[model samples]
Target: EPLPYSAILQPGHTLGMMGGGQLGRMFCHAAQSLGYKVVVLEPTEESPAGRVAEYEVVSAYDDMKGLDTLLSYTQAVTTEFENVPAASLKYLSSQIRISPSAAVVAVVQDRIAEKTFIASQGIPVAPYAEIRTIEDLEKADNTLFPAILKAARLGYDGKGQARVKSVAEAVEAFKSFGEVPCVLEAMLPLKKEVSVVMARGFDGKIALFPIGVNTHINGILSSSVVGVEEIDPTIEKAAQEAAIKIALGLNYFGVMCVEFFILEDNRLVANEIAPRPHNSGHYTMNACLSSQFEQQVRVLAGMPLGSTDLLAPTIMLNILGDSWFAHGGEQAIEPDWASVLALPGVNLHLYGKAEARKGRKMGHINIVNKDPQQLIYYARQVSDILH
Candidate 1:
């Protein structure tokens, strides 16, 4: 039986967030905009979200006092990152409810468990094998070639992943990543990378945002465009179905992202899962009826769900502050904001932070276009000028 709204959460109440990154900041804005309070549990004093949230607990994840204080006010808790320390989550789970609970977090935290779950669900994934030692790496030899070595835990933003193109590279890459448990996956010659970001409310109501097409540069997400240029209904259906299954199977009440690789045959093979609002879905803010952040708030607040339909075809360019060209500067290197703003349908969001580093995400820009190709060209131009 489905749980009642009152049993799950209350509106105009507080939602506690586990991490204080930019995602946290956007989620706080969404929650606060809708008349809900937010409590940010962050490790850094200068956390972007913590700076703006209603109540800020600037302490480690294990800070009992901070956790206790947050739980006292918030009706439910959620997270912006999947790498939260399970011990701290366990501590809080014993006291207050954490939606998309600890089990989902634990399962997604380890690459092995994630792959196992995907396979058990009969979902198609890249051919992969596990590695715990040099011997295990050798066993992966005949299984898959042109593979990637990935850490089983705590890896994101393209870190802890190394591509092995040749026989000797596999041996060296495994050793390079050291004694950590790992998974080696066959590299697919993908036609395009797209992702589905969706939210499942406590009422078992699932709303899916548009699928996003992602492009990467030097192992980092450089850009994401929403709504497949030539709407692949088959792909779209499969992507949304996968998200629904994952969210319901996880018994979740929050936003979740599943990245997909469009095989040459047009089949959708999942790349990975993100248990929070994803960078690829940033386009939703300008293109959708309701942003993913707001959808997350709605879900966690046990409120009516938001529409997932895209209002316009949109393109998003990430502002990685640490780009060697311009983003790496400690001080802000202002983009030609006037020029960018002059462009029709352009929306810019800059995260207010003191310092900028190499490859660190600072902000993003969105463009809703009647012509996606033209928008892509202009976006590249603006992003090039910005970086």
Candidate 2:
């Protein structure tokens, strides 16, 4: 049996993390500040997380020797992204405790599996069907027209997806993906998109942050605003309850973000689940009593989950790589950070990435003020300058 929560991981113990992206970077900072050592396994040179960690294996996720080395230094392991192979976690779990175990990761790694699992739990999900062979596409219901065909695995940031209005179009899009597994989801008339970020502890207790109202551009999250507009109390309650149910059902032991789509009729349908800390939750880093990253560390360390009260009604803007390129998309030029930072109440966080490519997530900025409208306006002004 795994160790109990009473034996919480001590402050000086080390933690191993898979993936060295911004999520892992933030987790590392949180862990380090709490007096834990972090070891990162990432192939990218000078990865965002690795740069801050005490040790980085700098190898592929499946590197056997590197995995062993990471395990040698840490008491527990966790991942930063769902795309990390489930088998990798499984391999590591044999020797160490890993939160949001490989089994949980496997379920959300594929869109079809994710939706199916959610629906099986009596949770609503956007109507979707699995598509692998062309025959499956041929048999798809005509009602699913104007669907989005997305790769079942490894799709993120609006990549590996295509809009299909007909069976022929879906076939073409599937072929473009080399006939990889895909999911066809009927588009819904969305009233708004929202997400709930929460953490489950080793003892099965749960803590939830407030639901965030989100806006996306080209399927990439652009901004997350909380408390800017009044959400129906019923809808907010349902979203929060459903989020907790999902985490409990998974017996998840770390922070997870569940995205939901609120229809015009005020119904809530789960869109997708990320099995780790998410971009939408970045606002919590500065706006909440305890940030999501801090929650992640606490959970993995078998420590009690912390309070998630919102400290301020806030707006968070994602800084994408497009902001680095000129307005016409001709060449790369850094945005005027001096002017952007000059704006009061702006908290800027730039990932120490060496290069910026179009559509890449570079960093984010959070604006917090007691007045929600003013927060949104200031956030927009700063985003406009950055863009």
Candidate 3:
């Protein structure tokens, strides 16, 4: 049964966050805006979210003192990153509310387990095989050649994955990845990639944002455009329903994302699920009536989910640290933010990190306008400056 409103957190109560990345930073903004206090448990002294939070415990996630301190201040907790140790959530849940519980996070943390859960829900996914040992590789079907071997855990942003065209290549890639447990997924004839970001309330009410068309470069997301043009209406509805079905099956509470691949034949295949606000949904911050971050806060606080209606067409461009360094990586060159911001509809957000390394997420820009064509044109201009 759904938790009742008596569990609904009041405005003045403090909320706890597990990870202190950009997602946590945005969540703090939303919670604070609603007159709630947030305490962040992050070891980093200068984490993006820690910098903005009212109280920050600069201790490791496993530190009992830090966890206790966070619990002392907050009645409810949520995690920004999914890889946070499940044990931490299990320990804290005995005391306070933790939305998208440890069980849900655990299932999504491992690639094989996540895909298995999605498939069990009657959702279609790519053909794949598991590789925990050399014998597992021997048992893999030859037709799955030209597959991508991905680490079962701790993989993100295109890291911890390698493409293999044969069993020999798969063996080498597995060894290169420290012989970790992995999943080898057959590549599909992908025509486009898109994602749906939605919020499931404590009462199981669901609110969905419009489909976001995503473009990635080198396994890292490069851009996302809301209100994708020329998409088949029936396909879009099916994708949205599939995401909702997955959320309902998990009995999830909070903003969640389901990524999909539109095949050459126009079939939509579930790619992966993110149990938190997604990077592709960053456009929601400016384009929607209520941002995904705010939805996260509402769900965790046991409050009603907010409206997800798109206020306007928007395009989001990711700014990576590679843009700060020239092609040779010799000279540091910061993009002309002033020039980019000069665009009428462009909104720039930079995470305050002191050092810039290759492929690191530095910030993002959102371009909002009535005409999708104009947003696309401006997005290209902005991308040129950043890249």
Give candidate 1 misplaced runs (Cα > 4 Å).
1-5, 8-11, 322-324, 327-332
Pairs clashing in candidate 3?
A: none
lDDT of each: 0.81, 0.89, 0.89
lDDT of 2 by residue, 248-311 (tens): 7777889999999999988899999999999999999889988999999998898888899988
For TM-score, the strongest prediction is 2
Which 10 residues in a row give candidate 3 its minimum summed lDDT? Answer: 1-10
| Candidate 3 lDDT by residue in tens digits, 229-252 | 767899999999999989988878
Candidate rank order under lDDT? 2, 3, 1
Please rank every candidate by TM-score, starting with the best: 2, 3, 1
Candidate 3 clash figure, as a count: 0
Residue pairs with clashing backbones, model 1: 321-327, 322-357, 322-358, 322-359
Q: What are the models' TM-scores?
A: 0.93, 0.97, 0.97
